[model samples]
Target: MEFGGMLSLDFYLHQNPDGGALLDWSRRLRIAAGAARGLEYLHKVASPPVIHGCVKPSNILVDVKFCARLCDYGLHFLASQERQGLAGYVDEEYWLNKSGASKECDVFGLGVVLLELLSGRRSDYYQENVINIVQWALPLIKGLKFSELFDTRLAIPFNIEPLVRLARVALACVGNSRPNRPCIAQVATILTNLEMDLY
Candidate 1:
C-alpha cells in the first residue's frame, strides 16, 4: 500500500519548511488537470459511479511525472455522526444533505484545491475581505488579474492563459447552486484542455 516517488500536494503547498511552493506554473497545471481527470473517472466513468466525498490538496498525491492521483476517494463510507470533511475543502451543504452530497460537494472541494494550487497556499487562506480562497480569488480572477492572484512563491510565466482559464473553471465549480456548478466531466475537460495548451 506504500506508493513512492509521490508526495502529497499538501506537503508541496503548505508543509514546506522553507516557506515556498515546490510546484512551478506548468507543474501546477498538470496537477490540476490530473486531479480533475481522477475526479471525472470517479463521478462519471466508474462502473458503480463513486463520489469523492473528500477532495483536498492533501488527498492529491503528485508523482515524479507531475501526475496527480486522488487518495481518500470514498472515505464517506466511514462517516460518523459528526460532519465528515476537511475544514477548507468540505461544503456545509454536504453535511446538511448527506445524500451523495449530490456530486457538487466534491466539485466544490476541488474548486478549493484549485484555488490552493493557484495561490500556492492552503484552503484556509484568508484576506481582509475574504473568508477563504474562493472569496479572495474570485474577484481578482474575474477582473483578469490572475497574475496578481498567483502564488508569488514561484516565478510567474509570461503566458498565463492557462492559469486564467483554470481559475475560471474553479470559480464555476464553487457556484452558489448545484445546477450552477460545472459537472465533474466539464471540469476535467476544461483543466485537461488547459494542461495541453500549456506546452
Candidate 2:
C-alpha cells in the first residue's frame, strides 16, 4: 500500500527536490500513459463506472519506477446525468447547464493536467490573460509546435512523436463538441499504442 513517496501527487510533481529527475520527458510520457490506463480501468474495466470529477497533477502520484498511480479519489463520485458543478476540475460544457457530470468531464480536467505537467506550471496560475493552462496550450498544440509549450527545464532529445500524440488526445478530451470526445477506454488504447511504439 505504501508507494514510497511524499504526501500527494501535486507535492511529488512540484515540491519534491527529486522531482526534476523523475519529471523528464520519458517519465512524463509514461505517467501520462498510466493515467490513461487508470481512466480506462475506471470507465471500462470497472462495473458502474467511476468519475474522478477532479484530475490534476497533484492528484497523481509517482512510484519508485516513476509509474503513476492516480490518487485522491476522495473527490471521485459516481457518474450521473443530473449532478453538475465542480471547481477548476469540471468540464467547460457542464458549467453552463444543470445536467450531470460524466467521464468526459474527468477527461477534460485530465487534459488540463497533462498540459500543466508538460508546461511546468499550475493550472490556475497564468502568466498573461490565459486564465487556464489548456487555453494557452491549445494554439501551440494545434500548430504542432512542441517546443513552444514543452518544459524548457528538461532537455527533450527524443522524437516528439509521443508528445504530439498525447497532445492530440488532450485536444480530443477537451473538444468543444462534448459528444465528439472519445471515451476513456478509447483514449487509453491510443496511449497504449503510443507507449508500445516508443519501445
Candidate 3:
C-alpha cells in the first residue's frame, strides 16, 4: 500500500536536472509498458474489474527504476463534485455527457499520456501551430518522420521502430468511439510486446 521514490511521470517527462527529458526512448518505452501492464490488471485481472478515471502522466507514479504505478485508480468511488469545465485529458464523450467515465475513457487518457511521453508536451495545451499533442504528432508519425515526433530534448532514438509502433498503439486508444477503442488488455499486450522487442 506504500511506495518510496514516488515521483509523477509528469516530472520525468517534462523536467530534468540537466534541463532535458528525464527519460529517453528506451526508458519511455519501459515506463509505458509498465503502465500498460498495471492498467491491464485493473481492467482485466482484478475481480469485478476497475476503471481508472484519470490516466494522465500526473497520475502515473514512477519509482527510481522508472517502473510505473498508476495512482488515483480508486478516485471513481468518490462522489462527483460540482461541475467544472472539462479536463484536457478526459475523453470527449465523458466531457460532453457529464456522465461517468468508463474504461474507454481511461484508454483515451492513456493515449494522451503516451503522446506526452513522446512529444514532451502536456496534453491540455495547444501549441500555436498545433491544436494539441495528438494533432501535432499524428502527422509526423504518419509521415514516418520519427525525429520530428520525438522529444527534441533527447537524441532521436537510434532504433525508431519501437517508438513508431508505440505511437500507433497510442492512436488506437485515442479516438471518440468507445466501442472502436482497443481494450486496455489489448493495449497492454501491445506495449509489453513492444518493450520486449526493444531488447
> Candidate 2's error at 93, in angstroms?
2.3
- How close is each model in CA RMSD to the real structure? 2.6, 3.6, 2.6
What lDDT score is found at residue 181 in candidate 3? 93
TM agreement with the true structure for every prediction: 0.88, 0.83, 0.88
**lDDT by residue for model 1 (1-199), tens:** 3488888988888897643545888888899999999999998889789888789888899888879999988877676646434555766676576574558888998999998888876666333454777777888888888778889887877877778787888888875567678888889988888888877
Q: Give the per-residue lDDT digits (tens) of candidate 2, residues 81-137.
A: 443324555676765756545687778877776776677766664245647666778
Backbone clash numbers for all candidates listed: 0, 1, 0
Top candidate by lDDT: 1
Candidates 1 and 2 compared: the better one by TM-score is: 1
The whole-model C-alpha lDDT of candidate 3 against the native structure comes to: 0.78
Q: What's the ranking of the predictions by lDDT, best on top? A: 1, 3, 2
Q: Which regions of candidate 2 deviate over 4 angstroms?
A: 1-3, 74-86, 125-130
Better of 2 and 3 by TM-score: 3
Give per-residue CA lDDT, model 3, range 1-199, as digits (tens).
4588888888877665642456877788888999988888988889988888778887889888878999888576473633232265667677566566788888888888888888887774533454777767777777778777777888876677788888888878874478899988889988899888977
Residue 192 alpha-carbon offset, candidate 2, angstroms: 1.7
